[model samples]
Target: MTASWKNINKPSSPTTAVTAAQVANGPVIPPQQRLLTYSPDEWEGFVEEWAYYCLPAKYKYVQRFSGAGDMGIDIAGFADDKRLKGVWDNYQCKHYDHALRPGDVWVEFGKVIWYSYSGEYAAPRHYYFVAPRGAGTSLSRLLANAAKLREELIANWDKHVKDEITGTQAVPLDATLRAYVDAFDFSIFDAKTALQLVDDHRATPVHTARFGGGLPARPASEKPPQEVAATESRYVTQLLGAYGEHTGSIVTHPSALSVPKLKDHFRRQREAFYEAESLRVFARDSVPPGTFESLLDDIHGGVIDTHDANHADGYEKVCAVTKAARDMQITANALITCTNPKDRDGICHQLANEDRLRWTRS
Candidate 1:
């Protein structure tokens, strides 16, 4: 059993945009909803949803538990194909507003151990700790230490377990339990179903079941919501620029580069280009370079901005920059051997404007 002495709070779900139809129909829910409500229970649901969605198709089905009289296990079930014997697992969810202390994990671990020994269908093959909002540094460190100890025990279980009659080896919960605790998108059971489960599982507070004991104070490093939004906006702008440049260069003619041609080029090569570049840039800068052909395809295919294309002012700027750069490159190549002063002066002015705009936008 993995235990920690941390407050088990929940994450709040954000307000979702409702359509006219949904309003008339009394709120039609989408498949994957963003978590606006932050609570330990809601966070747990988010984790379960993530596991269900991101985990391989094999790990699809999941079961959750909450409420009074329930043992330490908040979720128990299997993933993978139901046809083939599924992998058994259990989950413990914690949503701490404050940083999770080392002792929180210790307590959770003990409860898991007890639940394994005494609860219904107790000892699953695998277990998990699903903290959607995130676990504190202290809790993370303690879990790491517990994992090491669990490994040692598992390696020498025969020697550790005293009773030969039971034919049972010592099983450390940490050795078997996995942690699906991180920040990302997720989708699980419906919000209403999740809320009902939480209400049903509201039982005696388990905050004091400490083994290692006491919450450790730590500085919060979580970013504010506004900062996160700003970061995302900056990232999207860069992505559009890079995408425009790559696509424009690929499609433009040396003599007559047109906007229509640039858009057409993006349509043909967006997917392959995106696939090739997505890993490198999106991972680091959150900017994805889209090809000219791809951008056009997005526009024609209605995949870019569903609203007015004018709303994507950043994309327009990037396109203008890319077109100017391509033209400048062409003119520069054309004037490489020019000896006429009048021609040279005229070409320089044109090049200067292109350079100025390119620099300004980029």
Candidate 2:
């Protein structure tokens, strides 16, 4: 009846694992790597969302299953509607001030083995150990050599895993259980390092929400060569509402487009709108078919890097998207309008300009 993982508040930014190059060249380090910065609960939430956003489209649902009776499973990804008792993949999120050592996780493995043996649920096709800082050197080496990992698990069973799996009863690794353990698939046990998590999350919408990786450069926007459509009235209305609230005066309609102050607001609104749209467009154009959320993620972060390392430096990444990459201009433009030229304007402005995010009419 035991469960796994802690739960915490929802996150609000991007996540990146420090690359070997970044370590040598000194790019800004992501916060999740800073010792003890994120609580276990926060890591759990991060993984929960990460799984939800990064799992393949084929996985119809990725849900949190970390509390009591979870049977040592944390995030569960389901391909069918049957939910808990169906075909699924599990992600175990672990947060440690230090990298994961072998002793820290063997018990969790034993539980998985025991639970499956007891018919609590079918063994997952994949069982990932998600650690914020990643596995320790010793563990990493062992994992790289799967045969060694298997040997080590069996070698350490009596000391690190047996008692817990047995609990109050005398359920030792009897021949039946031992055979299962001997034949158990260790390939299912994999580690998701902080860097891998960051890489995987880079394409998800909530990446920025949790890790805060800034988006690419803002793309330059010109007045689209056509007259503003009447459909754009919503943008005009919201800008006027902001102006009214900011300056304590009322100005309505595109007719006000001629007024100097309001006109500036109009231009800015249009620019922001186009930019936001461009980002969403960029997201759609980029990435694989199943990643609508990742597109949102890129737009939200105000930057999207080409998966192929087309741009290496931070400056180049932003500029390339803004000036070089075809059709990704809007992604660049919105990032500039919302996060760069000014700091801390939420997606509301981005959406308002895009016409989908409406503001108070009154």
Per-residue CA lDDT of candidate 2, range 195-300, in tens? 7777877776555535454543445534533456664556556666655554456656556444576566456546655655555454443333434444344444
Which runs of model 2 end up more than 4 angstroms from their true locations? 1-29, 56-58, 166-170, 218-276, 279-362
Quantify all predictions' global Cα lDDT against the true fold. Answer: 0.37, 0.62
Name the candidate that leads on lDDT. Answer: 2
Candidate 1's displacement at residue 75, Å, is: 3.1
Alpha carbon lDDT of residue 92, candidate 2?
Answer: 85
Candidate 1 lDDT (Cα, whole model)? 0.37
Where model 1 places Cα greater than 4 Å from the true spot, the runs are: 1-37, 80-86, 147-362
